[model samples]
Target: MYHLSSLQTKAIAFLLTLFSAGHLSGQGLKNYGNNYRDFAGKAYYFGLSFGVNRSNYQIVHSRQFIGNESIKIAESNDGPGFTVGIITNMKIGDYFDLRMIPSFSFVERNISYTGYTNLEDNMTRIESTFFEVPFQVRYKSKPYKDVKLYVVSGLKYGFDISSKSRTKRLTDQIRLSPHDFSVEAGAGIQFFLPYVIFSPELKFTQGIGNVLIYRNDLQESTVLEKILSRAFTISFHFEG
Candidate 1:
């Protein structure tokens, strides 16, 4: 069974309590009216985002990794990353908006491999500087006082501006493609303050294609078949 860490449990409990309080407050019937009436009246708005991400790869090893006598084990480890972005939101309906965020991410991932007869493990660390653009459709719930809940679903296109595939010496290195596409989904709660809207969001991203560039000369690339990217991001957005 997968267990939540103590910190994660506490965080979940806190959010549940907050959501419950907001829901109860909304049911009191007394009109607590909207805070920023003019904010939503605008056709479009811009914002800024700062966030942290936990990134890793979902590996689908080839038959060689399992059945071949020369190969022992192969796996990947998660790494920490950060992001910064500019947010552009276009109002489409009373409850809908089109959102575009162009961002840069600094991420790292590690993969380890072992041979059948050798007890030693070889680990390869990959660093990617990704330029990403996400096109998302956001659906918001009715405002309860000054707070509202929203869900977003989207597609993201990313290019690794610092991919190692083009490096002169690729012989012993694990290489990845410069381009990738992913599907993304997330939910957030918005707090409409006096001057700006503050939102904290949690999102997930999964790659749609293999990002690995395989080379036969490299043993690190030979034991693997497909590599897909996955990440969980937590962001804070501020909009005027």
Candidate 2:
């Protein structure tokens, strides 16, 4: 069985509320014409984004875990993270755009288990600082005054820039792969301000590869057959 942590649950709830509020409020809003009337005529536009994220590992236990007497329970925990990125938008059509975002993120994933003696040794923490680039195709609805709704789907590639597993002793550390890839999908509402378009987006990402680096020396690594990345992000984008 799979379960989400409290943090993950709350984040999902918050995003759902945001979506509901935007959809409800939009019903009563009057059309303000095109907020960025002449803006789409340009070939490209640039923007900046800042966001908070929750990240974790999707752990699949090996047969070793089931057979071992020392291991009682195994689970993964999600934690808070932050991201900052530069966005480049290329207009493809009236309702479609190509977006590329190069971002840096701080993330952490934690693993916990219960031993026969209920000791503290059952916890392992992995930290990563990722440099990620995501390429997405965005589809937008017609603007209703200053508001527009959009959906985006894409692929992201990431490299862990702050991974210290190589420099550390294998005996004491849980090692992970430095590279990862994920499928991304999201939806957002764009609110045009006086001078900028402010967008609040909710994005979901699921890693496609097993990022776990198994080792014979580490019991934690041996117990896990695979670990995939999972994340939820709420981003605020400022575009011109």
Candidate 3:
């Protein structure tokens, strides 16, 4: 079994309690009147999710890093990452909801730079694990009672819990204590059931800041690459 940390467990329990209370209150309100004037129709939901995140590094310009033998330079490319998290949703209106997705993700990137030689052969690798929180505002359209379509736009903040960099001449690994932010958008469909609600959503995230911590010339290798990370996710919700 996967044991959750104390903080994670507490967060999950809190979300569960909120959902349970909201559900009971909504039901009670519905029984009292044909149409509840207040957001009493509002409810909360919680779920577990796992997905893949694609990550890349944004180089500011061409630069070099001091190595044991030779100077190293490089560009960046997309790398595959993984994510797992707890999701919470709060009903905002008849056709809208607010969602919070707290997740732990492993992100990595490969940087290839031009060496002192004319041929571009130098490269390095940087990997990091992050704790991310995404807050989203969703617009849902339900033509029928059993089905709903939704679109969400959100912002995410990520804290670097672990980081390392590797190269040929030097294993220059630095631990960075920093956080990153990004903007995300996505759309998906939901199937509503009497017992549970199943939602499969796909989202895209683009980092707004530079991911590199070093002030070296290597940062300039790929200045044109603006996006730092991207992810596609599918999540399911169990309603109580």
Instruction: State the lDDT of candidate 1 residue by residue for 1-240, as single tens digits.
Output: 012123333544565556556555556544434664657688887999999987878788876666667657787777889999999999888679999999999998888777766665677788889999999998776676677777778999999988755454545677888899999877778888887889998777889999888888776677789999888788999987
Candidate 3 regions off by >4 Å?
1-42, 62-74, 116-120, 164-177, 216-227, 232-240
- Model 3 CA lDDT for position 157: 98
User: In candidate 1, what residue range of length 10 has the lowest lDDT sum?
Assistant: 1-10
Of the pair 1 and 3, which is ahead by lDDT? 1
**TM-score per model over all chains:** 0.85, 0.86, 0.65
In candidate 1 the C-alpha lDDT for residue 102 amounts to 99
The RMSD of every model to the true structure, in order and in angstroms, is 3.6, 3.4, 11.6
Best of the two (1, 3) by TM-score = 1
lDDT of 3 by residue, 81-142 (tens): 88888888888767778888898988777666565666646555657678989999987653
- For model 2, residues 86-161, the per-residue Cα lDDT tens digits are 9999988877899999999998778888788856346777777999999999877666677777778899999998
Best by lDDT: 2
lDDT for each of the candidates?
0.79, 0.81, 0.58
